[model samples]
Target: MKRLKIKSFLGTAVLAFLIASCTDILNEEPRSVYEPGFFETEEGVRGGLTSMYAHLRYIYGNAYFYNTTQTGTDEATYAQSADQNFLVMDISGRGDITPETSRADVLWGNSFNNINTANGIIENGETVGISDALIAEARFFRAFDYFMLVQTFGGVPLDLGAGELAFNDNPVRVSSRNTVPEVYTQAIFPDLLQAVNDLPDNPRITGGVTKTVARLYLAKAYLTFGWWLQNPNNIPTYPETSRSDPDGNDAQWYFQQAYDVATTAIDNPGPFALQDTYYDVNWAPNDRNSEILLYADHTETSEYYNDSSLTYANGGGADNFAVWMMTWNYTVLRSSSSNTEWLGDIESVRREAVQPLGRPWIRMSPTIGAITNTFDDKTNDSRYDGTFTTVYRSNIDVEPAISGPVYNANGMEVAGGDPILTFLDEEPATPIDYSLPPEQGANVGAGVLPGRPDFVIGPNDISRRVYPGLWKLGVYRTDSGNGLGQPNAASTRPFNIAKFSELYFIAAEAAVKGATGSRSARELINVIRARAGMWRWDNSENEERIEDNSAEMVAATPSIIDIDYILEERSREYFGEGYRWYDLIRTQKWEEVAGSYEIAGDNYGDHTPQTVTRSIQPYHYLRPIPQGQLDALDMSAAEKDTYQNPGY
Candidate 1:
């Protein structure tokens, strides 16, 4: 593929922003682009390094990229307000995931651009008196981007218009692809190994790379590469080569290496450990806690530092709008101002920039399997409550113009801070009245529970238009005074990329793949499960709920742990964080696990589910080389066709 103006923009324009605007870096007049000589200076090396960290914002927080990682997976599907971007990803015959349509392009362009910058820094950092530790940061990120790329697109070019892993000054019109093994063994493994040895234990900045994270990625890469070598399901890899490793290691050797590295990281955690409870890991107030290893950060204080408008966000690149996808229109549920009857219809749940409420796009919703199968034990497990906004409380008090107690579900009086709508954990003994009209206090087709003052929907009744919202990633702001605070603005919270809790899961998964460990797969998995059972604060009830069901959770695990069980635990632990597609792909279980899923229709209150089948063929495993790349390549049509993946 050809390096075009887009790559030039990444190298030049983005560097200027990193130098002048990034709070951690020096302040200078912003230049439109940088020259080849820039990196020769110490300032340029430092500035390019900062740009590597900033580049994450262009990928992780972009909602379209988030959809590509999820929507078609078993965790989620397209919702009512979904456009073509969300629909095509569903793979349910809405539209084909063409080269033009695939959102994986976000990963493609941004990662390559960052890789080129990394190449620039690595080449000149030592000559300019930059520290080895600082230079290793660039190495870590280079490997990081390559790891993501190899997994997503099978094989990618190591040379971006230059020699292999060399800095390219001039844009080129021709490119060649590397083999999968070559990309992993040459590009990813070497850098990660060097980064682990050269990096510091603690981060230099608030959210910088460390040896532990390096080890984590190294172990993860080894694990994923081992799976590719095993080829249990006979999945085809592009730029195809033998499944053999270049280093003469078999799949078992790599799996054991993965287990060893992961366990080593676990034993030697410098500044990282799991949070006390599962809720503490994801709760908005507890962000940047010890559990989070790395994140793409944004500040609520400064518009410049936040990288977008603090008061209003257009929801483009650098905007954390992924949480908006699964959120339904909770603002539509109404309450009565008169206690006697349902006359004054007031919107009880106003949109607020809080953990439970944010701007709802309603573009994606969870599958029934995610709710009913993966998170089956809602009573004992705290993850279900922590992951979703099950109970939406009244926020009328924030709107000072409004007054008086409002009547709800049973014509019962309620004020602010009371539950207006509750997605019930279990079906109540009394049948829910799904046919009740809006005038009779039923709204959004949600059924009414007898004598309850909150509109109720059981887990089975969750539909495309109205369902639980993703609470873990919901908006949080300290500036919302007495009114809804910047609900329309993209979230300023840092989007977490890696967590400390994943070490255990990685080790356990490696063990399941036939590597013996000091702790068995069951032992490692139970550690996460036991933590999930402990709850210090209940999000839905809006109160402190001290409960410890660790033993119960431990007892619930099957005697023999398998890959499927590990995937289930992963979904429970890291739901809605864009990890599903990779996990399913790694195990080669995408078709078996997510081939067909059940969800309700788009209309509100329509709880009847229809099974939707996806066309997840073997060739679909590797996303198509983006059409933009094909258009830029200086080659014939046949060469371009040969360059693309088999199916698309």
Candidate 2:
């Protein structure tokens, strides 16, 4: 297989036609005009493989289907749909999902498209005497797509071989949803193992799949299987009637496998390493730093390649959907040239004044306890700096000087603004008064509170006004070097988050599961905490806080070890990366913790506490398989009965 010399056969007319139709059909179909003979050579195999890769890019880049669904219910974005039904049922809390509204159909379809492409490549490549290594890469890609499918939708239609002509007419969809464990053991694991065996440890190709990539995928599959299927921790098993019958212990085992694979990848030649400074390498557009172990390498000329210019709001590129989804919040506000000082006074503003900068909306709100408890110790954590805004300004300083002409609702400068001026001892210096309206005198911003404005008020003066319309996550770039003078400044001003610090938390969890040392989990957790600039356990304040050191704390703290701590760390680390909802569900904490926070001013009109309680029901554990596929299936009574997971 390695010795096979694949050749390229490009018939002139056929090749010309492919070139003509290439741009349009590249994403949808590649085989409509080309015959099997066209793919007989090495160059042809490369083109076919490249086509498969294009599908892979599409698979990952479907931000709306994947990121929105994940972030909507997960941790970052609170569902603010105007429809109460959509907010309460589809998001906010888990509820029975109608197949019609569910987005699983898109995930299923997109994944299978990649799988089908992989199948074509594998089958045709073999016939053309393509090397075993190429075949292995194809297999890895196929297995990965399937893994995503099975995890998401339970038993998806398994298409190991190429679809037959009759597949459309008399399609035979596989019955009996493969058990999660069975899928891991039979399909996912074998394919990955074979891929690892057949692929080079470090291939000559710069960006193609390698053994390390295969290991990473395999490890993740094993870890997930261990947790959901094996239930190593002896936690309550997911009932057979559940959408995906998962065993808690199996989940633990899968996590361990993930750690092992990550460890191996770390130890491999040209091993994975953390980027030195979170701000410099990870956040910068520069890719020279190759801390990324496995990533899609898109050259500057490649359509998939994204640069700072491509991501900039004024650069005619779409704002990163991930950044937009993660950052959109009613309480966040953008600063404008008209109000430079307003940026400093976001802490005292009301929810109405907060306007989010246009970006992918990714959010994960840490519990108040989570924030306060970790605050002092983690004051220096790179993540803390990257994730939250700490500065604030007082309202008194933000009020416009009395000397400035006051502008009314219609923007006309009004004469003689109220001049009692009890707040300041000196007469107002400016004619305009930008004081807060009387209706909103006492509201505080989400994170900070404002103090007295710059004006020196009379000793008896107690009135305080805050600057409104402050956006958190407020980083931005000006349109021109002339600063805020540019007309496009406000309109084109955009801020989107790309690199998040929470992946480190996930890596820590994986490490703990795969640890060989006596305190491997603790060590891994501690390393992450340290990276986050959290205080050591021996710190005086932390010691005092841990006076009782309950098992949960002890387990989470360095003194003791528990998975719960891992979960909590994950919650903190990945707060706005859209992992919260999934983490909560996986750890069985959603119902218990969902109602703790009051809905301050949700988009859905005034939902009462009674309306927001989320109880963990078995049905919600797995989203229902899309109904469209079910409609197409020809099912006998027993087969249909046995196939669908119980709750759905």
Candidate 3:
């Protein structure tokens, strides 16, 4: 019943001892050592369960890990300020993604730690008379982590140090991996099945594991494993094994199971349902809504609970700063106090801790395909308006501490709350002049539309240095009394991990892969498209906009639905949310979908779009094992080479 609460008691868990606190240098070593006796008590089991939820922070909201998931795909590419950390992941000529640079290490390290903690709870909690329902949460998380690991890095180890799926008290230097089939049949599928059978229909605590949540993961795992078995593209898997399932089921069988489980969850959603409109779903004030099945939680209430200061965050590890990457330096936008000649430039749009504006790192930018192609229906669909910050208004009241009218586009007088800049939804009939120099009042290289009061850039003119910021994932805080508040602070809003809408997607995708269901794939996708067409508020215009274009949206669906259509819908629904790479990988359409992209150069007025090709090799499907993992191994170089995935 609590609003956006991750039970406060999770902070008390002895995670340091359970994870065997390691130095930053050797953090990848899976040498977790929890005292077997601690988890033998009810309190200890509860603490371990809480720690499993807490572990999500290490990966979900991490910006670098975020890059690994998004940059190479069609949804996003490296921006102007991107460094080796981000550029390498783009795979568009910056460099190869080496083991040392791959941020998949975040998942590799944190998931193992959480998996071991889950192992301790599962092994010892039964001795203390812990309830099966309580222990099922551990099983859910253990399976959840293995699912993520297998998707990112093929054939990950199920046995950390002890026997297969057993708790290890002592650290071990050597390790071995389970094949994809073993990981699914032995670890992911079995654990999730138990979790679905035992977890409560409703969460015992806020954001706790539930039957619906377990079913979602179980369904997703089945779907992913089916894709692996099909191997339609013949993508190689390391520590190689035949595609034959241990349970003797074919890919189509697994696909059918996935569809059945997903549709079952969709039918019996417990305390979870889709938000009425797409705007309400990602609205900062409306976070932690029913649509979110799981999230990595942060709070504005206390720094101790937030894991970083709510007042300020330097965009480091464990902070929910992933939103900062796609944010451009909108604060650089300027206006003048004069109509004709250039008077002193005034900061019109200052940074604020609001949904549209946040700390700008400019490390990643959405690909042009994301803006113009994926979200082509800007008028009929509310999703395009809901997803991007296309308009910037003057905020003299918040920053610059000024009081007077300023002149923006066409030397028009503007007050606070007036539009300063706007990314035009589509190319205009009137030309946007990019020839004007910055000193001549064309600040930040933004072109001015004749007779308009706001600087405007058409879709084609969106450069690497200037583009629409991701509005859905932007920062929001209640404490910014009158000024900018804590614009630099990590967002207190929970980083959503799973959503109820995904059940529809999972089921739809499974159905496309040869699973017949009561509902057709088109019907399932239309459910989401209809919701996306409903608009309660306009993000760009910043005003109340009550409109229901659901009929038009549904009518616009193709006569037949396929994988490509499903993927396009996914991008529109979940852009810039770290879902692109995996979605493409699951369908084996990464290379075909994201083989090349187009974006302009990274200067203020540079708007010449150039196509850049990506070198997406088959081995790129699986990320290399992190260098830290290889260094921690007490094995020979040849053995380590054999241990690592090929083409690293």
Which clashing pairs does model 1 show?
none
lDDT of each: 0.86, 0.40, 0.85
Query: Which wins on TM-score, candidate 1 or candidate 3?
Result: 1
Residue 568 lDDT in candidate 3: 98
RMSD of each: 3.6, 11.3, 4.4
lDDT of 2 by residue, 304-415 (tens): 2232132233322122223332232323322112232232222221111111223322222222233333232342444443344222221212233223323222122223
Tell me each candidate's TM-score.
0.96, 0.62, 0.95
lDDT of 1: 0.86
Q: Model 2 residue 113 lDDT?
A: 44
Off by over 4 Å in 1: 1-32
Residue 174 alpha-carbon offset, candidate 2, angstroms: 7.0
- Candidate 2 whole-model C-alpha lDDT, 0 to 1: 0.40
- For candidate 1, the 10 contiguous residues with the lowest summed lDDT are 12-21
Among all candidates shown, the one with the greatest lDDT? 1
